[model samples]
Target: MPATDVVSWLATAYLSGMNDELLGDIINDVQHQGDTSEAMYAVAPHLLALSQKSSGKMALLMLIHAGLISASSQSQIAVPCPADLATEFQATNNLGRSMVLAQLAHNHEFDDFKYLIAALAGFSGHGRFGRLIEGFDLYQDQFHHALLDTPIDDER
Candidate 1:
């Protein structure tokens, strides 16, 4: 991975820990999605790629949603949490396969990896839900913000 991508991942991890209190609402929303495999799946890369093309509010909203989902599912630490995992989608479609990609994108601790992989498994079993999330265009500014927040790494 490029130093920049590593930096981006680091920033998200840092801010999430620091902003934990402020992000309760968003966290819950993401957890809700994680609770259901039918909801968010393993569509990280595609969502990340799609986010780049997003134009405005839709992009921001989706991006935030996507990030939360990534963290929620990927946060292997929360594996003990009960979730309502749905069936996986068939890989017959291109998008469905992409959602599976999200599952493979997590760079979290063991606990996070467990949660994410489980969520991805559930979503993949759902037929096409994972694919649908993959097709969404969420504008994620993590890379930009991560790069900009380089000065604050010491705070972590």
Candidate 2:
């Protein structure tokens, strides 16, 4: 499918309240085999637009996916992002950063505030940290147990 078509379908499906499983298809179309396709750059601007005009889970997910795609483009094994696409992606990324900051500033309650912070980290060029934050929930119990078992030293 053409990148534009993919964007259109994604928007329609998202607005129509598609399940995340189906939406994962759109994400997979742009990112597969541990790398992003050129289509990701093309779809990024549209994702940014969606994020801007939407709210809640869908918007945050769009921003995080786009930021992850941009970050993956920097990996040594991945194709180098085109200069033009990089410029456009950076503009979108900056806008996403601003949106996240605005949300944080409002002190709004979020069901997944950690994901929002993760998206912010990715937009700020700390993709690894962002990923770690995103994965924290999966390991929350283990982390808590480890912390409880560890002895703290009061003396330097």
Candidate 3:
């Protein structure tokens, strides 16, 4: 199956109430099969949508965090963060930690961003976004301080 088709299937399966472990297995199977470069771009808009919703944004955050923490085989793709959305994401209260996570993930320069985006859409209505957001809120200050401590290259 094509990567896009697999992504669509995964999204449909998850939204149709598929089990989490099963979804992960499916993702693994797909990743094992071949390259997913096209799928990466295909899923960016979906991630953008998730990032906009209060209900879905936490899932996006979690997926991004997870991808950042663990190494994934899929190639990295930068999902577009529109100017307005970028501003809103920046303005989000207590989201500094999440932003730090995103920056770290981006800097890692590996792992497909689309996978996280798909996972976010797949986890829609899962009710765990609340806990995820709460965790971020609880740790935002520490992450902000950590970010401040790290020196950024002005040249980049």
Q: What TM-score does each of the candidates earn?
A: 0.27, 0.68, 0.28
Task: Tell me how far the alpha carbon of residue 7 in candidate 1 is from the true structure, in angstroms, after superposition.
Answer: 31
Which regions of candidate 1 are displaced past 4 Å?
Answer: 1-41, 77-156
Candidate maximizing TM-score: 2
Candidate 3 clash pair list:
none
lDDT of 2 by residue, 15-121 (tens): 77544664577777777654667777766676777777767777777766766665665555666566767788778778878877876765444425666777788
Cα lDDT over the full model 1:
0.37
Candidate 1 lDDT over 1-156, as tens digits, reads 123433343345345431333233333433444453322343333333444454343333334445445434434343432233322212212342354355457435443443334335333443233323333321332212222433322324
How far residue 130's Cα lies from its native spot in candidate 2, in Å, is 2.3
Number of the top lDDT candidate: 2
Indicate the worst ten consecutive residues by lDDT in candidate 2. 138-147
Score candidate 3 by lDDT: 0.37
